[model samples]
Target: MSIWISWMVAAGVVVILELFTGTFYLLMIAIGLVAGGLVALMGSGHELPYIVAGIVGVAATLALHRSKYGWKKNSDASQDPNVNMDIGQSITVKEWQDNGNGKFSARAMYRGALWDVELVAPAAAAGVFTIVEVQGSRLMVRA
Candidate 1:
């Protein structure tokens, strides 16, 4: 069989496999195979150099995927119009710290709940301010 025909067949099979596995990674490989097939059809050479093509395809896929959806900060706390919005927001401590790790229990109304919180850091005293860093069914506080 000619190099072009082989490449074409390989590309078709890659595409079919990509369909079976919905991962974008396989689809990227298929794209690379298609590129190699096209190169073969152009009579670049009989040996498609699949390794190089695969690398290029994978790289292209990752680059495109990363660009399309990357890290994003959660600004919903500020933008969300809800009652419990103040749960993760910063708050003032009404009580004092009694330990080295700022371990103290204090009462603060947040997200419409009267929470029993112990500060994670002891250095943060009763008068100083802190943030509502975590909230479960209960709340965890930090300085």
Candidate 2:
């Protein structure tokens, strides 16, 4: 078998594996394998192809690691609207059951279900509130 063909096969295998993992790291390595295949196709020395592949793979991985998509934001998922669709959505709090100790909470209907909601701060009761965060089944809201 031709050396270039072997490199292409390896790259194909890596790409297939990448589909299952859903991360781009394997895709970068596959790109490196494709680079090796290109070097071999140019009739470079066997050792030269290996070196090119290694360098390309490492560089691509590092580049990906530096990209925004590669790293997750530090924001809490409960407060992020992107993670919890309920965030930023408004709900009605007909009344507040004062828990005393300077805390106010109530059960409100949301998304066709009853939800435990608490004010972000101890404030006067209001008919409307905006969801700020979700903790398990409980929702934190603000006026």
Candidate 3:
């Protein structure tokens, strides 16, 4: 088989693998392989196609890595509503207990279980509170 045919076959295999992986990096390399195939079809010297493929693949991967999709915004799982389903849920704090560290806390019944609750600030003894953060089994609340 011709060198161009080999290049095209490699590109097709990479594209097939990219489908299962569901990431664009493999697709970029496949594009570079296609470039190599095109160069081979133009009757370039044997080494030039390999060099062009390597350069194009690396450049495409680097460009993708520098794009916005490459990075995700770091978020605290306890406070981010998307991470925790109970972050914005309201609960009733019938009383606040002084932990003696100048902080007030209470145990509140939530989601059919009693959860340890900590107040964000010193508030009145009894009122409805919104869950702001969840640290383990403890729910941090703000009035």
Candidate 4:
């Protein structure tokens, strides 16, 4: 087929990939493909169309990366119950001992993993404790 047809075909493939990926990043490449296709149809030299396409793709993609559209930060991911189910879940401590740091600490089994737990302020004597928050592999607890 013609050079322009090739470019259009590539653009269509990228657009289809963007749908599956749920990210608009491939759309930026599609923009460049369309640009190159236009130049190819205009009878530009072989190298010129590719150069224009690369420049347009890179520039447009960078512009998109800098924008706060698809590149947004979700502040709720930290607090979302579905995202972090262990936040409100309970943890059981065999014993709460003050190894240091004033607050009581213990090694407890949570989700089949041994976690270093720190009881908030006045620590519980022992037994079942509710998980207040989790930072890394450590658990912050409240009795």
Highest-TM-score candidate = 2
Over 56-136, each residue of candidate 3 has an lDDT whose tens digit, in order, gives 988988888788865567989989999899999999989888988779888989999999999997785788999999999
TM-score of each: 0.50, 0.81, 0.74, 0.53
Name the lDDT value of residue 109 in candidate 4: 90
Candidate order by decreasing TM-score:
2, 3, 4, 1
Top lDDT: which candidate number? 2
Write candidate 1's Cα lDDT for 65-99 as tens digits. Answer: 78734333465442333535545566666775465
Segments of candidate 2 deviating more than 4 angstroms: 73-75, 97-102, 112-114, 121-125
lDDT of 4: 0.86
Model 4 per-residue lDDT tens digits across residues 48-134? 889989999998899999998657776654345668788778888998877775778899998888999988758558888887777
Q: Residue 121 CA error for candidate 4 (Å)?
A: 20
lDDT rank, highest first? 2, 3, 4, 1
Enumerate residue pairs that collide in model 2: none
Q: What would the TM-score be for candidate 3 when compared with the true structure? A: 0.74
User: Per-prediction RMSD in angstroms?
Assistant: 7.0, 2.5, 2.9, 6.1
Off by over 4 Å in 3: 20-22, 71-76, 80-82, 121-126
